[model samples]
Target: MKQKVAVLGAGSWGTALAKTLVENGHDVMIWGNHEKQIDEINEHHTNTHYLPDVKLPEALKGTLDLAACIADADAVLFVVPTKATREVAAKFAAVCQNKPVVIHASKGLEKDTHKRISVVLAEEIPADKRQDIVVLSGPSHAEEVAVRDVTTITAASENLASAEYVQSLFSNEYFRIYTNQDVIGVETGAALKNIIALGAGALHGLGFGDNAKAAIMTRGLAEISRLGVAMGADPLTFIGLSGVGDLIVTCTSVHSRNWRAGDLLGKGHKLDGILENMGMIVEGVSTTRAAYELAQEMGIEMPITQAIYDVLYNDVDVDDAIRAIMLRDYKSEQEFTFN
Candidate 1:
């Protein structure tokens, strides 16, 4: 079935997914606040600022009118940055009349509210105008997926049917999506892994060897899994694509904005300078603060996340933060003991 899909935000991920939807034979109208980018997508079929060198599917339309883009669509996908999620959702709520399946491809919690993407969407988009909310996340990067690289992601919803419907929307050979019921686990893992990826990049910036990176990756996963579990996420989800899977890719890949930002920070570039130069949203920067706050609230011990947060916010020296992490009180590596 060819459905009209409204993809909000014309960033790399949004444009890439819109291309995928068009290739899958859906009518896709992308919405963005940037007029120049929207014009480029419609007239040039390329988002040069984001997905340079990739030609978007010609049929993919771009619009600045949020109401027009989403009106009468079968589904809406939010791909904006975390800070912009609420504002977009509020505008979308005011203009959209159809009760389409709500899906968000962005990851991160609202800064002070400490709410997940789904929660932000739910708060703004009324129940009557929105159907079951779904989250699409995993290790897939927009640059890879833009070129039709084989990528797999998970579509999660509390409603199984909603997840399956989303799975049907973009399940071509090049882009595969699986459905999971653990929305919390999937979203939590997707949001938190960026923080660890920052740490990974910092380690690399510090000229740490593979052993150091390996330790950070392993211990990072432990801390991520711990916080996820504390927040009602399934620990096993962290091991899956959204958890460990997403972590490995973000921590290592040049395609990851978070990793790149951290790499810059690690190389002695200041946070403000790094972000100003990157020209993209490095989610982990904001996520580190949000996750740190959440961990404190939940009484969860997430030293890796804290260390990164302190480095970014508290002006703690990366070397001192690392030494502190290494010298922390020792305990059994395993979370549980056999009786």
Candidate 2:
């Protein structure tokens, strides 16, 4: 069935997803706060700043009015940044009268609350205006996904039907969607991988070879699984798409903002300077702090996340922080192995 979908946020991911939805024969109305970007999408069918060199689907429309976008929409896809999710959801709830399936593609924890994106949406959107929230995450990058690369992602929700619904909506020859019921595992893996990407990028910037990068990726997955399992997620979920799949892609790909940010930091650039230069939201920079604090509260040992946290926020030298990690007490790497 042809559905009217509202894609909130005009960033690269949002534009790319909106275009994909259009290609799937859905009427996609993308809503953004910036009138200029909305006009660009409508008039030029291009979002040059975010998805440069990619032509948007001409049938896709853009809107500045939130109400118009939400009116009679069958589904609302929240593609805004992590920081703006709560605020945007609250606004979405205020204007939306219908109970559409709520799905978020963002991958990060809320700064102060340290809550996952699903939790934030559940709290912000009233039950009357929303359905069970769904999370869409995996190894897909907007730049690659925009061009229809063979990208695979997972649609996870507490309800299997909801997840399957999303899987059916997004699956195409180039873009495949797998359904998983482990929301906690999927969200945790998706959010925490950015921190490791920072570490991976740092390793790259510090003149480390593939051996060092491999070490970070391996140990990083361990820490991510440790913290994820501690937070009530299934340990095996880390091996799936949102877990190892996302970690490998984000930590190694040039399309990763988190890796790029970490690369700049590893090259001795300040956080503020890197953010300014990147002109994009580097989720790992903020995720490091959240994961660091959450680990402390949960009594989970995440040394890698802590090391990146200190480098990003504590003003510690990257080399010194790395040395501190390397010098930590060593034990069996298979301590958490499935026996």
Candidate 3:
């Protein structure tokens, strides 16, 4: 089926996804705020700033007019940063006339409320104008996906049919999509893994070996599962693509902005300077704070997240944070108790 798709956000992830949709034989339009980037996508079939030197499909278009981009579209995909999601969703809701299968690829919890992205979208997109919300997430990266590298991801929704529809809509030879009904687990894992990735990158920057990275990643999965289960997520979902799978790629891959940001932090760079230099959203930075607060409120024992949060928000030195984690009271590996 040839459906019109509106992709919100012209950043690296959004552009890569738009390229995927275009190759999948859909009528795809990317909605962005920057006029220059939009013009580049339209006139040159390129988004050099985000996906440098990667030529977009000639059929793919970019637009500043959100109304025009989404008008009569069969689906709306939100790939913007977590902070911008609500604002963009509100704008889209203002002009969306017909029901579209609302989907989001962005990963992160709301800063203060700690709500999942799907919850945020459901709140903003009118029930009358939207179908079930679907979340597309996994271990894939924008740079790799932009070049047509083989990638697999998950499409999760409470509505199984909606998840399957998204799975078919985006799947291709190189990009495979799996369906999962655990929206809570999928979204929680997707958002929280970035925080762990930051810790992994910091370990690298601190000159730690693979042992440290493995410990952080292993314990990080436990933390993610703990919080996720507390929020009514299926515990089994943590082992799937969106959980441990996403953790492996983001923590180790150089393409991860959060990892890079944490590496800089470990190397004595301030958060402001690192963020300014990267010129991309490091979701882990904000996620650390949000997760820290959420964990505290829920009484979840997430020592690694707490350590990263201290370093990121409390001005604790990275060395001190690492030391704190190392010196924490020893516990059995099977200490995880799902509420």
Candidate 4:
């Protein structure tokens, strides 16, 4: 029952997933655009650039050639950043044949356009060739996942049978995968949570305790849910794995790039300086732009998201954004729970 699998992007999440597939006894190949990453994975069984500390499984073959990586694979996991999705997927469109079920581990809505990762997938990958598109998301940190830290994620597809199939492929003792059919909800929940996480990180960096962080996490989720509902997603899906569960993990984890970046930014360092030092994609930064705009279109009140947007994109001082969030018009804590 071994199926061929390909994982594009050799970043922490991508490498961990490729390694997981290999451990699951599947034929897994990883595609990296950088030749050095390919060499590191092939020769040293490691991805020195992204997830340098962890060792990758030997079964996870790495290659620069897209055709070789996608060769007859039953599943293809796209783990590239949100900004790169369209361009990389365009190139993937040419070489990927017999459209396999795609799994997107990267989370973000495209800047300005507000297109979710799956939307980009559908646009780039021809419909006739597509089998099923799936989203895998939850409270997962690549650092914890690499060390096998009891990670649980939801594997969701529009088709129940396909979702179960994808779930069965990854569920194990260390890793547990659930199934959901709310594709839009799952994707939105996953993407929007990163913004909340960034806000939480800033709270932490500003010497705010768990109380303030918890408040942001709670209200942040409300904003995300409101926006998702406005955008055609089921409300209850926000309560599930893809929503609250993912939000908690990302906001609290030290391993979160968005959180870490926001933490540094909160400490009064310039955005350019922080990013220059980290050399990683803080999805929340760009996702904030998308979320901020999407909320305006939907007319939902998302103070936390708007605050983060100002800090990242509007050149507003981090301390000022924090003050704005604190001074927002006060309302009942359960304003959304009118029942």
Off by over 4 Å in 1: 336-339
- Of the candidates numbered 1 and 3, which has the greater lDDT value? 3
Local accuracy of candidate 2 as per-residue lDDT tens digits, 162-202:
99988888888999999999999999999999999999999
Worst 10 residues of 3 by lDDT: 330-339
- For model 3, the local distance difference test gives 0.93
- Can you write out model 3's per-residue Cα lDDT over 1-339, one digit (the tens) per residue? 999999999999999999999999999999999999999999999999899989999999999999999999899999999999999999999999999999999999998988899999999988998988999999999999999999999999989999999999999999999999999999999999999999999988888989999999998999999999999999999999999999999999899998888888877889888998898898988888899999999998888899898888889899988888888887887786452
For candidate 1, write residues 1-339 as lDDT tens digits: 999999998999998999999999999999998888999999999999999999988899999998899989999999999999999999999988879999999989889988999999999999999999999999989999999899999999999999999999999999889899999999998998899899999888889988987898888888877877777887778878898889888989899988888888888999999999899999999999999999899888888999999999999989999999989888787762110
lDDT of 2 at 4: 85
TM-score of 3: 0.99
TM-score winner between 1 and 3, please give it: 3
Which pairs in model 3 have colliding backbones? none
TM-scores of all candidate predictions against the true structure: 0.98, 0.98, 0.99, 0.96
- lDDT, each prediction: 0.91, 0.91, 0.93, 0.86
Off by over 4 Å in 3: 337-339
- Per-residue CA lDDT of model 4 for 288-325, tens digit only, reads 88898888887788888888888888888888887887
Worst 10 residues of 2 by lDDT: 330-339
Regions of candidate 2 where Cα sits further than 4 Å from its true position: 336-339
When sorted by lDDT, best at the front, the candidate numbers are: 3, 2, 1, 4
